[model samples]
Target: MRLSVLGAGAIGPAAAALAASRGHEAVLWSPSGRGTMGLDGRIAAEGALSGVFPLRVAQGLEEALASADAVLLAVPAYAFPALLPRIAQAMPAGLPLLIAPAASLAPLAFEALRAGLGPRAPVGALATTPLTARRLAPDRVRIPAIRAAVDVAAVPAAATPEIATLATALFGHACPAAPDVLQPALANANPIIHAALALTNATRIERGEAWPQYELMTEATCRLMSALEAERAALAAALGYVVPTLAEALHRASGVPQGRLAAMGAAIAASGRAVLGPAEMETRYVTEDVPYGLSFYLWLAAGRGVAMPRTAATVAVLEVLWGRDLRANPLLEALDAAGLPRLLREGIGR
Candidate 1:
């Protein structure tokens, strides 16, 4: 299949390389238009899948998306609102649009704007990104690992089988069906993890102190993450799904010893994985994860009347630090819990 991969950051280039390795035509585009397009349309990748692969880097979004059988969005959560509308406009009807690591509320927000795009524009949200990757250089990327399994939630749930097949084929991971977008969205581990990490390390981040992120996850931070996890589990229960906590998720992903969630986090931190910390306070751990992630969790909790004091406190701290009301997300507020299941299964007004 010809795949149009958007956002030429860590995951995008790695995904393009993976597609090329699988004998699929993968064209890449950078919405920011700042990255170095590969020399002669080629990118060198290492780590998990190592090789110099041939890829077509498009000059414009339309050029990248045109005639593609599938579209994969690899941008951050904050970029979805602006980018998805442009993609919906340029993409031909019926093309499969997959959001890698579909952060909470992204699919709903996208579906809201994607009205009238027709049945062909089926959107699937993956619970997490396919690869743990980084840009090694302007023309190179390093992928450390692929997740053990992927949960995909498709709007109009009927598309789950096709999307699962395609996603598994493309990434060589077990792709399972999620009940609806809420299942996968709540299953996301980043917001809880990032919320804890960012809040605990706020002072260090402000001072530009650098350390391994996971290593800095102290007992206090892990306790906070566990509290948020409990709140998330309650929210998931209210929504009629069982979501795993961050520690269980880590154990499943990397075989971290399972006991206390904090110990699990400590195990992950001491695993010598070379994961780095945010050098500045204005990092995505607080920015993207706070507003688009934790705040959205609070929004859902409010609708369900589930108290998430820890989660709310975390986002509130971020709001004070960032000088913006992180909890005031209109898109999330516009989406009500009563209408969510139908909205996930169908579209906004359907």
Candidate 2:
């Protein structure tokens, strides 16, 4: 299989490298062209996956999509609105498109656009990324761990098996099917975890001080996370979907024991796998997760007549701190909240 990976960030390179290691011909394209610069068409991976693999760098989107059997989007959640439309326009009909760590109902947004865009492709979403990694340099990445199983779902639920097979083939890991896109979208725990960390440690982030993110997951912060989690679970239940708890998700993803939230944090810290917190206040933890993740949750809650006081309060505080209306998401604005539950389960036209 030939894979075309979009985005050139840590996840993109790590994904391309993993695909190459599996004997699939992989090509990478960075929209800015800077991520692939100095790489000379090669990628070096360390830690969980160690290898020097040959890579092909595409000069443009068309070049990347050409001759590719499947397309994997590894970009951040904030990039979805602009990037998805362009990809829909350029991609060939019937090519499978997969979004890893899909959040904020991105797959539904893409499906809504594709109805008029004329593409017949099936769009799939992953609950979280398959690999935990970071960019070490322009051409290198550090992969800390590869997940054992990743939850997946497709827009037109029936296409799930095909997407799951493609995902498992590309990553050499299990890609379990979810009932619908809602299952995977609501299953993501990053927004809740990051919100607590950023709000409690705002001063440290604003000061640009280096700190271990998990080490600072004090009892109070964990309590806040639990409160947020309860709200999220309530929203999911209201929608008739039962998703995993934060503790269950962490245990599945990182081998953290399923116990109290603070104990899980302590175990992660003791294991020496905890990464550093953001050095600055303007990071995906606040920017991407707040508007796209938490705010989206609030939107769903409003449609379901469910109260999410803690979740709403978190969004309000972050908006004040950032001095901007973070909930002004284009995708959420375009959606019909009253009809979204059915739409998410039944795709664009039902």
Q: List per-prediction Cα lDDT, in the order shown.
A: 0.78, 0.86
Q: Could you give candidate 2's per-residue lDDT for residues 1-350 as a string of tens digits?
A: 99999999899999899999999998999988888988888999997899999889999999999989999999888888789889878888678889987888788888777776553767888998888788989889988777778889987788889889989999987877898887888888889999999999988999999998878989999999999999999999988888888897777667877898888888887885677889896798988888888998887887568999999999999888878787877866667778776776677843
What TM-score would every model get versus the actual structure?
0.92, 0.95
lDDT of 2 at 101: 76
**Backbone clashes (count) for model 1:** 1
Show the lowest summed lDDT stretch of 10 residues, model 1: 327-336
- Candidate 1 lDDT over residue span 1-350, tens digit each: 89889998788988888888988998999998876454468889886678998888899998997889888999888777678778867877678888887876677777777675555556888988877778878789887665777778787677788888888878777877888777888887888888788777778788888677766677887888888888889888987888766865676555567787666656766664446777787687777777777887877777567888878877877788767777655456446677776788776633
TM-score of 1: 0.92
lDDT of 2: 0.86
Whole-model alpha-carbon lDDT for candidate 1: 0.78
Q: What number of clashing residue pairs does each candidate have, in the order they appear?
A: 1, 0
Q: Which whole-number lDDT from 0 to 100 does residue 225 have in model 1?
A: 85
Superposition error at 333 for model 2 (Å): 2.9
